[model samples]
Target chain A: MNSTDSLIDQLAQDGAAPRPASLPRFVAPLALAMAICAIGIALVLEAPFIGMAINGPGPMLVKWGFSIALLLLSGFALWFIGRPGKATGATMATLAVPFILLAALLGADLAIGQRAFPGETWQRCLAAMAVMSPIAFGGAILAARWLAPTNLHRAGLVAGMFGGAAAMTAYSPHCPEHGMAYVAVFYCLPILTMAALGWLLGPRLLRW
Target chain B: MGKQTDFSGDTLDQLMASARAGDSAAYRRFLSEAAQRIRAMLARKIGADSELEDVVQECLIAIHAKRHTLDPGRPVAPWMYAIANYKLIDHWRRRGRSPIEFDDAADMAVAADTLASTDIETLLEKLPRAQADAIRMTHIEGLSNREAGERIGVGVSAMKLRVHRGMAQLKKIAEKDRI
Candidate 1:
């Protein structure tokens, strides 16, 4: 008998069974890690603006809404891309939606009278981005457990976006600033950091 | 359809289901029939007899391992198609052969046994049996993953994974094996 036959015989001999195809089971942990680090770090730092996000005028809701949406969308995209296959164009498009939505909000901000670059807190943006690096690292490591994605670079890019969103959510509680322009420009800093990390390091870490 | 072993359409699925239920005879018959289909698929994709030889074994091994994982009530074709596609992509990637970036000699087959060997060959020997065998057939013998798997009697997808891993390991080894 051929090797194939032997394998089948072996299965019959051993009673090997099958299981259902899996979804990315790591999403919860990654989101929680981002929240813990963001909130935990914020608590330690005693940033004055910590609980102000829940109270909202319409503008505040819009601002906070975008980051939260990004958090969910990017997180799911990262999970989907974590598997072995081409990152569907639909996934790419979905990931880009928050940016487009936020950018449009920024345009409206400028039309009304907001400064285009009210991001005097550029240093904070850099810090916030740095803070999420660990969260991203955690997500990448967690996702790699059995993911074995075929396109590591693309997966990494989405992974960064996902983790970065989670980090940005964590950091959001602290920042005194509130507006779409601030979020569109500043919140994305970490997302960019994540993309770079994913691009450079993902192929090595995520290989199956 | 006349013989219990003659697989086509629903007959193949029924045989596989029976095999999943632990009928060794049905399992054997199912395997032989499936191997033929897998062989045809590999031959169609790879078009080379030597390379195709090894992967068939891996494909069979994979299918056997994964048999219990399938929902017996469901149609098997979709699952097999997914496995076949995965195996084919994997086979093509190994066929790409990493192009020997650093070596001056750049020869994939090095040392003794042009009859069949390489620095690639040496590394392949150290791999797990299924993976090593898959690579030995696909890379050295130039078989597709399906072809290699059928030869060894494993699932195509499992063989593909073996080939992929085997090739990846070979790349690392090749870095050291560079002459």
Candidate 2:
């Protein structure tokens, strides 16, 4: 046998061992902690979807959906944490999906409401965008850290695109009456800008 | 109990069991015993890089934090080696560089032998058989936690935890020796 093997044999004969616990125990607690924190943040921010409900869907359905989504997101986060190197990119991509949808939906709602641009509604839209921008960036950072993708730039780009798409959906309803032109200028531009920012910042912040 | 032919064996297994049960003292002893071997293995793999000790320490902490996955009946060397190897890979990947492959088995053999003498074996003499065996299979043999678990008939998570705690104890011992 080689020296390493011989040494192993020697150590085997000497015998100083240890016993440690598994990953699930730690992961479960961590998942719980993250869920609690996320819920607390939602409460603090008074996130509209958390407590309020759309009339047709009923409050129960809305609450259940929200709870389910939170649970799923928490589970995803735990998975990402456990395998930081491989899950970061996937988590970022997954997170951007909801954001893009929300943004578009919000925009569409504004459009239907005939909320005037460069007015109170526009101000709210801008404020919402500003708030969301940091959130998207922060989420991307977290995803990159967890996934540990080889090409972070590409991961960021994907995250950005997903974010833009989700945001467009949320903002679609609120689009101004100027038709497609308004949608193109208002919705498309901001989404693109956010996407670009995600792509740019993700790599620098997510490096191992 | 009966003239105790396997004194080290029984003691090591007990310590491992205690660590799994969350005994901090056993955990420390486990780390103390494994540190030198880890250092030696790392030295062979990466030469005398300035970050060797840090890498070893990080690997040990990871092992400690993940030890409940180990099996009581198996060896520990392969698991430790795998962790060290992965850490080195992470270091290179973070630097945007691919791992440098060893050119030949002879070179690897030489390095492995050199690594075996990094003062770990001497420390192992203070340990028990089961602990030593677990350490050897996981750290020295480079087996996966799952594979090691299978050999010892324990769950993968248990094997991982055992490896983790064992490495932590070894590290503590090495630090004490250095001091």
* Model 2 interface RMSD, one decimal: 9.2
By TM-score, how accurate is candidate 1? 0.60
**Winner by lDDT:** 1
lDDT of 1 by residue, A1-208 (tens): 7555566567556543333343424555675677676766666556545436544555545645766787677666665554333336798788778788878877887788855366556677658667766675566557544444455677677777766776666666566566666676677766777777876777667643
- Interface RMSD, Å, model 1: 4.8
Best by DockQ: 1
Lowest lDDT 10-mer window, candidate 1 chain A? A15-24
DockQ of 2: 0.05
Candidate 1 regions exceeding 4 Å error are A8-24, A28-32, A48-60, A78-87, A116-120, A196-201, B1-38, B53-179
